[model samples]
Target: MSEVIIRDDLEAMAESGLLSDYNRRRLTAARPTDGAMLALNINLTAICNLGCTYCFAKGGDYGRITGKLNEGADVESILQFVKQNAARGETVRFEFFGGEPMINFSTIEALCWRSEALGAEQGIRFLYRISTNLTMRLTERELELFARFRFTVSVSIDGSEATHDRNRPNKAGRGSFRAILDNCYKVRERSDDITLVARMTYVPHPDSSLVADVEALYAFNIFDWFQILPATVSRELVRTVFADAFGDLAYSEICRLCADKVDSEYKLLGEIYMLLFRPGNRFRGVLEIETVIRMLLEGEVANGHCSGGRNYFTFSPDHSIMPCHRLVGEAEFRVGAFGGTIDGEAVAPWRLGINDTPVCRDCAIRYICGGGCKQENFVATADINRPDPEKCRFQFRLVHCAIQAIAESDAAFRARRRGVLRDLFVSCGRPTLSSGRSEEVPAPDRLTHLIPLLHAFD
Candidate 1:
C-alpha cells in the first residue's frame, strides 16, 4: 500500500519537485519575462458605496487608508508612470478601480484624458476598464467618455434580488439590486462591449436555488459573465443574511454547486486569460480552464487574478500596498506601498505561487490549488500552511455537480457545450498553446465543464 503521508513530509516532497540546480540555472537563464507587462490598476479613490465587511480596504476607516482620496494622481504623477513604462516599450492600459471607482469619476476622467493624450504621443493605444457598484449615479457624458475612451466596465451584481439584497445590502440596509439593474440597462444602451460581471457571494443554504439565481442575472442584458466569490462574514457580519454560510461548506462545494447549475459560465471564467481579457461564447460556458490554470501556475496572469504576488499590488486608498486586493487588511499582510517600491530581491520570493508559502510548500495539492486564495491566507493567520480546505472541497463538489448537470441536460445541448469546452481546454493542455503569447488568448466557446480535472484523472 502507498505509505500514509503527513503534511510536514509532503512539504519536503513538494520542494523535492523543484528542478535540479542545473535545470534551475537553465530556466532562469531563459530571461523569462520577454517584455514589459501590459496594464496597471490606478486606484483613484478608496471610497466605496456598500461597505462589505471583508472589503480589503477595511472600508470607512479613514485611518485604515491613510492615503488621500477625492484627489486625482496628478496628471504629472500618472504621466510619469506612463511615460516611464512606455519608454520601456510596454503599451500602457489604464484600469480605474476604487471603493466604487464611479465615486471618483472625476479623477477617472482626468486620468482618461491624460492617458489618451499620452498614448497618442507615445504611439501606444491605451486600454481602459472599470469595475463599479452601479448604484452610484453616472452621467451620459461619463457613458460617452467610456464609449470614447472605450472603457470595458464590469458592474458587480450579486445574483437575484433576494440573494443580492440579502448579502449586498446598502448602508441603510436597503437592497441595491434594482438600482444595479437600472444602471446595467443604461450601460447596455451605450455599448455591447460593456460587461456586467455578476458577483454572487454564496451563503450555504441556497443549493436548490442555484439555477434560478444564475438565470436571474442572465435576465440582465449586459451580464456577459458571472464571477463567484466565496461569501465572507467577519464576526460582526454574522448578523446579516449570508452569515451562516461563511465557512460552512468547502469552496469546492461552492464551485460544484455553481458548476451543477451554472458551471459553464463560472468555471470557464476562472480560466480565461488575465491580460487583454475577452469574453468567449464559442465556448458555450462548458470549457475547462486547465490551460488557464496551468498558465497561472506558470506565472502568466492578468487583471490581478493570478498576481502570483508580484505583477500587481492592491492599495488601501491610503497607499498601503498589500500583495494584491485579495489580502487587504490583516496587519501581518501588508507588503509595501505607493510610498515605496517593493524590494526587488524579496518580491519574487514573497510571490504566492510556486508552492512558496509554508502551507503550499508542504501541500500535496499545491500543484492544483497553488496555495489557495492569497487573501484567504490572510484569513488563516497562525496556520497559512493549513489552506482553507473548505475551498478544496468546494472545487471538487463543483466539478461533480456540473458533470451531473451535463448528464441531466438534453444530450444535444450538453454535447455542444461540452465539445466547445473540450476543444478549448484540450488546446490549453498542449504546452505550445498554454504557453503561447501571454498578451491575449482568443477565447473559444466555454468548453465542457470539468474537462480539466477529467483530463487529470486520465
Candidate 2:
C-alpha cells in the first residue's frame, strides 16, 4: 500500500511561482477571456428515465418550468444563434444537455446534421458534446453518428454498483449500473471516440469510502478521463430532498469530505506517476487537480470558475438563456431568451471575475479556484459572491498536495517539472524561467479535521 508523502521544500516551490502558477494562471484565464461566445449549451428536454437522488433539475419532473421546445422554431433559432457567433472565427462548441439528452434523440440528431452542414458551408468549425445517463437503449446508427461527428460523450455514473444504485436508481427503484456498463461496452465496440469522460458526483455519507469508490470507477478501464463533483445542496431544500441521502451532515462537512477525497485520489495517482514515470496519469481527472496539471503542462490559464454569462451560456428548451445548464430555470440567472432579445447587461453581474469579488480577492486560493462555482454559492448562501468556506479550504489542501508531490521528487525528475513550468510561464506571457523552483509559499497542513472514514474494502 502507498503512503502519503509530505515534502519539506513545499514553501520554496510556492514562492518561486511554480506552486502558485496554477492558481495565477487560473485567475488569468478567468479575466479578459478573449473571443465571443465560444460554447453554448442546449438543454434538449426536461425528462429523465433514471431519477438520480442528487439531481438538481429534479429529473425534469416538474411541468412547463421545464419548457418543451417547438422543434421547428427552436432548432432554427438555436442554429441561427450559433451561425451568428461562429461568423467571428471562433470554433463554436455545442453541448447537448438533459434530463438524459438521448431522450430527445431526434432533436439532437436534427440539430447536429443541420449544424454540421452549415458549419462546413460557412467555413466555421464546430465541436459537439453530450451529457447522458447511458441508461436509454442506444442504436447502432446513434453510435455511428456520434463517432462520425466526434462527440465528446460524458456519461453520468457514480462509483460502484451499490453506491450507484443507492443514489441513481431508475424510476422502478432498481440499479442501472449493469445497463450503463453494457451500453458503454457497445459504445466502445462501435467507435474510438477519443474523448470519453466519466462524471462522478460524490454524495458524502458516514458510510462513504472515497478510496473504494474511486477504485470501483477505475475498474472499468473504459474511461481514461474523469471528473468528480461534490454534491451541492441547498439548505432549505435539503430537508425536502436530500435528507435521507446525505444524512445530518452540514455543508462544511460535505466540503471536508470533498477535500479528503481529492487528497486521497491525488496521493494515489501521484504514487502511480512516480513509480512509472508517466506524466499522463496527471490527466486522469480533467476538471479537478488534473486540470491544474494540464494547465501547467500545456501552459494555459483560465478566468474564474466558469464562463457562464461570459464567453458561454446555456439555452433551455423554450429558448430561455441562463449562465449555464446547471442554472437552467433559476429566476435570478435567467438573463434572456434566445429567440427574443437578450439583455447583456443583465448577465454582467454574473460575469464578474475573482478580481471583482471582495471576499475572493483576499483569498489565497482565489486565483486558483477562480472564485468557485457561482451556482453552488447561490444555492448555499443565496449570494454568488459568498464563497463557500469548505470549498475554499479544500482547494488550499489540494494545491498543497500537488505542490508537495512535485517539489519533493528526486533531482532527476526536476527536468520534467521544469519543462512543464517553463511552458506555463511562457504561455501566460510571463518572463522565461531559468528553473521551476520559486520563492516558498507555506504548505497548508493536511486537513486533519476530516470526517472519519469507514474501512474502504469492508
Candidate 3:
C-alpha cells in the first residue's frame, strides 16, 4: 500500500476564507438536500486567444463561442432549458465554460441579469461560476459582475514563467505567463476581496517545482487557491497532435509528490479530506478523486458518465444536453437535446453503471474509478461501449494509493495511540510484589478500555 500522510491537525484548521458569504448563507439555509443539485454547464463560447497544445475543446479557431453553437442558441432555448431545470426544484448552479468566457462577456452578463430576474420570479437560487484562461481583454466591469453574482472565476496558467510558457504557450509560440500575470494583477488591483482560483496543469517532470510555483502564485497575491491538473489528451480525439503532443508523466508524480508536501497546508488539507470522505464534495464528485481535485480547484466539477446518476446536467453551446462535458459532439453520448422539454426518461441511460462496459465490469476498482475516464472512451477509444485500459489503470492506481494512505494514517494513529494507552492502562494493574495473592491472573487479555479507540480510529 502506498503511504499517505493525512495530518491530525487538518480537522481543526480554519474554514476557507474563499467561501463567499452567499455560499455560506446558502449552505446554511439549504444543507445537502436529497432534492436535486443541478449544474448547468453553458459552454458559452469556444473561441480563445491562447493556443495551448492539450486544449480539450480544441479551442479558438476550431469551435464556437457563447450560449450557442456556431449555429447560435437563442434566448428561448436557454430560457426553456432553465425553466425545465427549475421545474424539478433543483439547486441550480450555472457555470460558464469556453475557449474564453470573457470573449462572450455580454452573453454571460445578460444571462446573469436574466437568470436573476427569472430565478427571483420563480424563487430559485441561481448561483453562477466560470472557468477561464485569464487574459488582458477581460474588462473591469466583467470582473465586477462576477463578484456581484458570486461567480467564482477559475483561471489557468501552467505553473511558472518557463513551465507555463513551455506547455500553455500563446499562438505566437511565446510564454503567456507575463500576460496572464498582468491580468491577474489587474483583478487584484480592482478588488482585493475577489475570490480567484488559479489552475495549472501537471506535465511530467523529474524536479517538482509545484510547491515553489504555489509560493510564487502566493507572492503575486492574486489567486486565493491553486488548481493542478494532469494535461490530458486522447490520440483518438483529434489526429493532428494527439500522438506527438500528449505525453506528460511528470504531472502524475507532481500530484503524488504534492500529497506529500502539502499534507499540512491548511486549505488543501480540507479539500483532501472532502475528496476522501464526502461523495458530493466538489473535489471527489468526479468519481476519481485526484482528477476531480484538479477540476474542483479549477471550479469545474464534472458529473461525468460516472456521476450522471448523482446530480448534474450539461448543456453544450446549442443547449443540446449531455451527461458531462466530454460527451459533447459525440452523437451516441447525448442524453437528450434541450430543444424540446427535457424528458427525464430520455436522459436516464447515461446514469452511472448503465454505460459501464466489459473492462470495467471485470475490474476490482470499477466503482471507485467509475470505469475510468468517459472522455477517454469517447476520444481515445471512439466507443462509449468500452473502457480505456490506460485510463482505468491510472485511476485505479490513484484511488488505491489514496485509500491506502487513508488506511495507513488510520493505522498509524491507532498503533501509536494504542501502544501508549495500553502501557498506561496496564501500568494501573502493575500491583506490588508483596500483595501476591496473584489471582488466576486473568492474563493480559482483559484490557478493553485502552484499545477502544481502535474502533473509531480505524
Candidate 4:
C-alpha cells in the first residue's frame, strides 16, 4: 500500500504557513486573462427518463415545461449562431447536453451532420461532446457516428449499483444501473476511439461511501476518466425539507449544510494520494485532481472559474442563451438569445480574471482555484463575484494535495504519467499548455519549497 496524506498533514502545513506562502507567491505571479469563445453547449432537450431527486435541472426541464430542440429550425439557428460566434479556422466544440440528450437523438444526429458540413464550408473544425445518463439504447449508426466524430461521452452513473439506483431511477421507478452498465459495455465494444468518462454525483447519504463508491466505479475498468461531483439539492427540495423557513433563508441554510457535508465527506487528498501511488492499481484519473495536477505541472494559472460566459455559452431549447449550464433557468444569467445580440455588459463580469474579484483578490490560491464556480458562488452568497467559504476550503485542500503529489512523486513516475495526461488533453482538443509556450516540468530541487510541506508517499 502507498502512503496516504492524512488530515493532520494538511493541518501541519497550514500551521507552518507553508500553504499561505505558496499561495501568496502564486497569486503575485498570476496574470490577467480575456478568454476566447471556443465551445457551444447545446441543450438538446430538457427531458430525462430518470427521476433523480437532487437534479439541478428539476427533472430535466430546469423547472420549466419540458421541451426538446427543433431539428430543423433550431438546428439552423444553432448553426448560424456557431458561424457568428466561432472564428474561421478555429476548432470549436459542440457539447450535446440535456436532461437526457438521447431523448432527441434525431436532433443530435441532424446537428452533427449539418455542423460538419458547415464547418467544412466555413473553415471551422468541429468537435463533439455529450453528457448522458446512458439508460436509453443506442443504435449502431449512432455508435458509428460517435466513433467517427471522436465524441467525448460523459456517462452519468452515480457510483455503486445500490447508490446509483437509489439516486437515479427511471420514471417508472425501476433501477437503471444495470441498463447503464450494459450500455457502457456496448459503447466500449463498439469503439475504443470514443472517450468514455464516468461522471458520478456523490450524494451525502448514510449508504453512500465516497471511497467505496470510487472503488466500485474503478472496478468496472471501462472508463478512461472519472468526474465526481457533490450533489447540490434543488431549492424546492430544500424548502420541503425545511418547511418552517421562508425562501432565501431555506436556500442559504441548505447550501451551508450541503457544503459542510461535502467538505467533511470528500476525503480528496488521501484518495488522490492512493490513486497516484497505489501499486498495481487500476486507477483511472479523476478530472478534478488531474486539472489541479496539470496546473501545477505546467505552472499554469486559471483566468476564471470556467470559460462560461466568456468562451463558453449554453443554448436552450427555446433559443435562450445562458452563461453557464447551471444558470440556464436564471433570468439574471441570460446573456442573450440565438439570432440576437449578446449583451457584452452581461458577459463582462464572467470574463473577469480570478484576481479581479474583490473577495479573491487577496486569496492565496486565487490563481489556482479560479475563485470557485460562479453559479455556485451566486447560489451560496447571492453574488457571482463572492465565493462560498466552504467551497473555498475544499478547493484549497485540493490544490494542497496537487502540490504534495507533484513534490513527492519521483521523476520517473512523473515522466511516465505526464504523457498520459498530455494525451488526454490533446484528445479533448484542450490546450496542453496554459502559458501558450513550451511546458517545462520543474525539477525536484526547484519544487523544494513544496517538498517540506508535503509528506512523501512511499
- Count of steric clashes across candidates, in order: 33, 12, 12, 0
Q: For candidate 3, lDDT tens digit of each residue in 300-328?
A: 21122343423455666655676666556
What are the per-residue Cα lDDT tens digits for candidate 2 across 17-136? 344344444344443434233677778888889867767887763334565555677889888877665574556777787777788887888888888888878877777778888888
Q: Model 3 segments beyond 4 Å from truth?
A: 1-36, 61-73, 87-89, 189-193, 205-221, 236-311, 343-349, 354-357, 361-367, 397-458
Q: How many backbone overlaps does candidate 4 show?
A: 0
For candidate 3, report its TM-score. 0.62
lDDT of 1 by residue, 176-215 (tens): 8888888777876887555444545555344435445656
lDDT of 4 at 401: 59
Expressed as tens digits, the lDDT of each residue in 36-107 for candidate 4 is: 336778898888888876788877888863578888988898888888877787767788898789888888
Better model by lDDT: candidate 1 vs candidate 2: 2
RMSD of each: 9.4, 8.3, 15.0, 6.1
Rank candidates, lDDT, best first: 4, 2, 3, 1
Model 2's alpha-carbon lDDT is 0.61
lDDT of 3: 0.49
| Candidate 3 local lDDT, residue 282 | 19
Off by over 4 Å in 4: 1-37, 238-261, 276-283, 416-458
| Candidate number with greatest lDDT | 4
From the highest TM-score down, the ranking of the candidates is 4, 2, 1, 3
> What overall lDDT, based on C-alpha atoms, would model 4 receive against the true structure?
0.70
